[model samples]
Target: MTAASPRIPSPLLLGVGLMLVAFNLRPALTTVGPLLAAIRMGTGLGTTGAAVLTMLPVLFLGIASVLGPRVSRWIGPDRGILLASAVVAAGLSLRALGGLVPLFAGACVAALGIGLAGVLIPGLVKREFPGQAGLMTGLYTMTLCLGAAAGAGLTVPLQDLFGGSWALALAAWALPAVLGTLAWAPFARPSRAPVAARSEVTRPVVWRSPLAWQVTGFMGLQSSLAYIMFGWVPLILHDRGLSAVDAGFVAALMSVGQAPAALLVPTFAARLRDQRGAALAIIGLTLATYLLVVFGPLWLVVPATLGHGFGLGGCFGLGLTIIVLRVRDAAGAAALSAMAQGVGYTIASLGPLGFGLAHEIGGGWVLPSTLFCALSLGAAAFSLGAGRNRQV
Candidate 1:
């Protein structure tokens, strides 16, 4: 008798699990920005220290992403994600204990979890929703942005609710991670029979491919912009004369704007013959809106923030979509996902750190703004190659 195929969960269950897991990915990073001032006051952290704290999650994200494929191969993606969620929950809890050591340690642990999920989820989407890659990627990216928005917007209120304890506010995000772990548990049950593996010869070595490098460059550059928003935009707004609450709300608005664009951009881009125009348009919008937020009339800030969010969200979604588009098979997607996110996020970690240093050294936002514009141009250049209609 032929061996029975392993049972699979219903599509609805799988989709819900995937999104819930995605929701756990960003709060660990976003919550820190709005709470940075309070945390620094409590912990005696200076601007440089704050920048290092902000950069830690992103730096570890790259490190853990490099290990994702190997971990998935050993434990299976579902189980790996389950473990990641649990780690995130634990890290967030640790971060709430109120000290510099715990804070940095927790951030690193949480980032590692986020990174593993980041690398594994794309391959899972490509494997499970092959025909609906664009739609699913859009949905996935939208959920991710919503998570970020929630963290950015709710954190200050949460601090108030906790009677001005930033630690408690930061700790509140752990609940989602715990919930995600439980929600994904059923799907993470090990298979009854061992699965067979494909030959190594068929897997593409994406590290050597120029097309893969182009995609990685786009992912990194665009992500640098996204992380800058996540890490510094609230503080930037505060410096422009907004209250902490107002600054956080504006940052959250930017993240909220990302939702619709994240949902639409990839779906639209996937339908086009080449995504180069879409890529260039997104970069242009990003640059213009960001400049307006920083230097244009104060009255224009809200609309400009929204436009910035939309552009960055589209840029991020397109970056993820390009990973799927550039490869032909699920295995190829997994391999390329690992390479792009691994090296790409490593490159991305520099942006927030550089921005912070520039702000401190120059005593203004102008230097940082220049750096941001330069990164946008670099991303635009790489997008030209990454958005081409060719598979690696």
Candidate 2:
């Protein structure tokens, strides 16, 4: 008798697993912003140290992403993701123990998990939902924004409920990580196909492609802006005289605003002949709205924050969509995804660091605002090339 074929997960199971995993990607990063003041007060972390604390996770995200392809090859994508989720749970749980060392260490570990999932998920989307890549990516991105909003919006309340313990509030995110890991567990069984058969016949060298570089540039620059929102925006608002609760509320609102755009932009972009126009429009919107939030009348900050969120969300959704659109096969998508996020996020980590340093040195938001503008313009320049209807 012939040997039995390995069982594959149903589409429903796969879809649920994918979204749950996506939902775990942003919480660890987002929770920090709302609690930064409390964390600093408790740990004596200065502004620069706070920046480093924020920047550390992103830096490690980039470093870990570069290893994604290799890990997938060795363990399979399903197993890799399972491992990633488990690591994230452990990291978040570690954060609950308190102290500077635990906080930073936990962030690094959780970020490594997030980075691994980030690189692999796109390729999985390409492989499993080839016809619906855009929609699926939109859903994935939307889920990420929702997770971010939850973390931003709920941390303070959780802290208050837990007798003012920021660490406990931060640790609460681990529950989602655990759920994601459990959801993905059924799919992590060993495959009947040989490992070699799962890989590309001829792997594309993504690092050498000019178009790939443009995509990476766009991803990096936009991600810098996104991380800035996660790491410093609330603090910036607080500095501008908003109460902590109000500042966190605005940050949460920004993240909530991202969800609709995140779900819509990639779907719309995919139907177009090219995404160039969409890219330009969103980048302009992001830059304009961000400036308004930083400098416009306080009465208008809420609306500006929402607009900024929509712009950033659309930019991020398009960035992921471009990666899928630029590749014709799953292997190519995996390679491109690795390049875009690996080098891209390394470039991204500098944004928070730059903002913090600029604030410290210039002693005001002017210098940080200048840096934001420069980064936004650079992203626009690269998006022009990345948005082309061409395969890498």
Candidate 3:
């Protein structure tokens, strides 16, 4: 008898695949932070060049996300994601080989893959697990946070383990990408039945919807803060006299807080009438955390890290959850997701680059910290409107 075909997909299998993919999404990005100082010194990149290095991937993410819908149409969700995972694997592997050009190029490639996956994964959840968007998104986001924390916390040790070769350490993350691609390949084949099919529309409904824009605003604002923390917190701590390893540990502490919030907040928010109160509270707490980071004594760093992380985890998960809740069908969800992330990431890309420039110009973290305060207040303002209970 012929060998049996691969086992048919089951919910448990799909869930595992989703978690694996989610786990892979952030390593390529987060690994850079722990190694930022090494990268700058090794490559002779000044602050501006370093900023560009950090910004390029996020910029590519924005640009790629904008094309997500078209790509989805071309390859279908299953193949599109498979292609993205392949890109991530190739990028991470290439980046590990050494040299500034390879480093930037590899990051851009991985970001492109991440961009496509970032847009499509939510739509996939909306379509496949229609009744469980909250739980799935929570699981997916929590895994994302866990992956990020692992990358940030481990890269330095990995570098040391490899005899202080940052290149090898960066390359190590590629393994998970390869594994994720393998885990996802079987499930990436297109399904026959389309999800939540709707009639063709003449205009882009999501673009014109106020609610869509508000959701996009929330996404952009929250992401701006998250990326800043990811891109600079280690460096910031290092500047404040902490050693690289210690800085990484502190950053990891912040990241650790994200996992629980990412796991729980979306599910909780889904049950609320208007998520405004919760959203505002999180933002307010985040602002307070920033203040502590900026001016509080070193002894307070642990709590500050935890508070900031919890805020980011809840805020980010809730932003994605809003996209799912604000729409009616999978089609709308896809459109909304693409728009929010496309425009949102495009806006958020500036945070790291801009803050990097601020530090360079001011020659210290104080000016940048002030700017972050303004950004925190602004994000809070936008969250007010975005958190309203209105469907797009």
Of the two candidates 1 and 2, the one with more favorable lDDT, higher being better, is 2
Backbone Cα, N, C clashes tallied per candidate: 0, 0, 0
RMSD per model, one decimal: 1.8, 1.5, 2.8
Query: Can you write out model 1's per-residue Cα lDDT over 1-392, one digit (the tens) per residue?
Result: 99766688898899999899888888898999998878878778998888787777888999988998887788877788888889889999987787888889999999999988888788778767999999999999999999999999999999999999988898889999999889988888553432225423123568778889999999999999999889999888988998989999999999998999999999999999999999999999999999999999999999999999999999999999999999886667777888888889999999899999998898899999999999999999999999999888
Q: List candidate 1 stretches off by more than 4 Å.
A: 1-3, 189-204
Residues 311-376 of candidate 3: C-alpha lDDT, one tens digit per residue? 888888989898888887776777888899999998888888898899999998888887787777
Model 1 misses residue 123 by how many Å? Answer: 0.7
Residue 36, candidate 1: C-alpha displacement in angstroms: 1.3
Give the better candidate number (1 or 2) by TM-score: 2
Highest TM-score: give the candidate number.
Answer: 2
| lDDT computed for candidate 2 | 0.91
Residue pairs with backbone atoms closer than 3 Å in model 3 (clashes): none
TM-score rank order: 2, 1, 3
lDDT string for model 2 (1-392, tens) is 99888787787789888899889999999999989999999889999999898889999899888999888888878788898889889999999899999999999999999999998888788877899999999999999999999999889889998999999999999998999999899888764454335544224567778999999999999999999989998898998899888898999999998999999999999999889999999999999999999999999999999999999899999999999999887777888888899999999999999999998999989999999999999999999999999887
Cα lDDT, model 2, residue 2: 93
lDDT of 2 at 363: 91
